[model samples]
Target: MIERTVKYKKPSPKPEKNRDVRLPRLYKSLYDQIINNHYKNALKTVNKLQRLDTDNEELIKTRIFILLQLDQFSHASSLIQSSSQPFAYEHAYTNYRLKNEHLASQSISPDSDDRKWKILSAQLLYRQGDYKSAIDLYESLMSDLSPDTDEYTDLETNLKASKECLDFHRHGYLQAMDELNVPPLDVLENNPAPFPDNYKPPAIDTSSVTVSSATTETPSKLLKQKEKRRAAMHSKHANKNMQIDPERWLPMKERSYYRKPRQQMSINHKRR
Candidate 1:
């Protein structure tokens, strides 16, 4: 035995917890994009993070939400199905957005302690046209969420939309006009001008509105795309209106299948 005691190999020390191989800056950027409603950019960041932290539950949830926001429902649905362990709320939400209501209801955890699941349930109810149920659920859930949180803000917004949808479903456009004490545009356009001859609407003051350098400069690619969408929508709407035979309103019996309602026409006109 030339050397009975061989040199022992020392084990390497574990890296510090804070020194984990995660792109914290990129994660923060993803969060910032989500908060700013930049879902397209957020989706891109999610792919980057997945390369590093594939098992992060929050990232998976966020990626599903971003996909939904981007109207990539097929991708969202596939993601939900493929995820090893999807969050109940996110799974329910993605299913709801994909119009799989039955599946969405099944995914919801009745015993879930998370307030976000309740919010998703309410949202599903709203989408199902159960506005009253959604409203009640929202009211109940409101007590659990802090008013300062973004979740609460979103809940409030959904509540408002549910109420609006309920009202629209219950009351016809004519009834809404009566309730609001506003003249319907078709009536106004068909009849004489409400104001006296030579009466002009007051000119809006443009002095208070100053165009910033950013506004004057060429728009960003994203903004330009948005503008293009708006332009296309405006053009399509204009073409539809031009094709409408204002002189002959479609018969009530045929309206459901063949004609767009006068109220819709008025609404579209106002959108211009």
Candidate 2:
């Protein structure tokens, strides 16, 4: 009878939903840090989670939260490859990634508020050199063109670019004709002097209007950057004109290899 006797072990109490032994108190601490706006501290907690876990929703969620806060759209997109919950953080991150890839990519659900970040992502996508994507996003919001009007503005910009390309390509043949010293027959018959050899348009001293990309650069603050750039450009250009003598033009707004033409104002910053 004594040999048959056995002892039973009691089961452990269940941990809370937001916290558990598996997740650890560290996550709770991270949450507190997040609430306190201590993002750096929260990031440390996330790092600890990464070291221990292999693949888990909680860890993914933690990473997502951190990435979104830091605006690491590309990083967050990679972490959450595929998830079932559409409304989950992973879904949002996935949409964000897709949007960045192409503004018109159908990442958001049907009933999404395009005005919400869902639309902003499109602008960003274009700004980042994804023209095709940016165009797509603008097309979808044809109805919501009233409020932000970003869609309309962006659309007009894209249209102008398209027209410019068409014009350039269509007239490209003229350059070759002119280069071969082959003027149209009508001109040759009517005028005694054929087009002058080494004949060139008076170096078409065009005052090109620069179109700068609203850059995501060393912005003191995101909202104020554009305003500041505009103000500075105006001042520089005006001052340059006001001075008795203007030196070289200020730095031009350079665009990435593939993107919209960055318009810059040739502002003279030198004082009169």
The lDDT values for all models are 0.81, 0.61
Tens-place lDDT per residue, model 1, 1-272, is 57667888899997754525458788789879989999888888889888778777888878887987888888887887898874566667767877899999998877887777877788778888899999999989887779999878988998999999999878787676668966778987899856688888899999898887765666586689788887877655366445666536767666545767799999999999
Q: Which candidate is the best by TM-score?
A: 1
TM-score of each: 0.42, 0.31
lDDT of 2 by residue, 88-205 (tens): 4345545645554343344545466646555555555554556565656666665556645765776667645644544664777767766896768998899897687888866654
- When summed lDDT is taken over every stretch of 10 residues in candidate 1, the lowest stretch is 235-244
Candidate 2: Cα lDDT at 141: 61
lDDT of 2 at 150: 62
Question: After superposition, which runs of candidate 2 have C-alpha atoms over 4 Å from their true positions?
Answer: 1-24, 47-56, 82-99, 114-118, 121-272
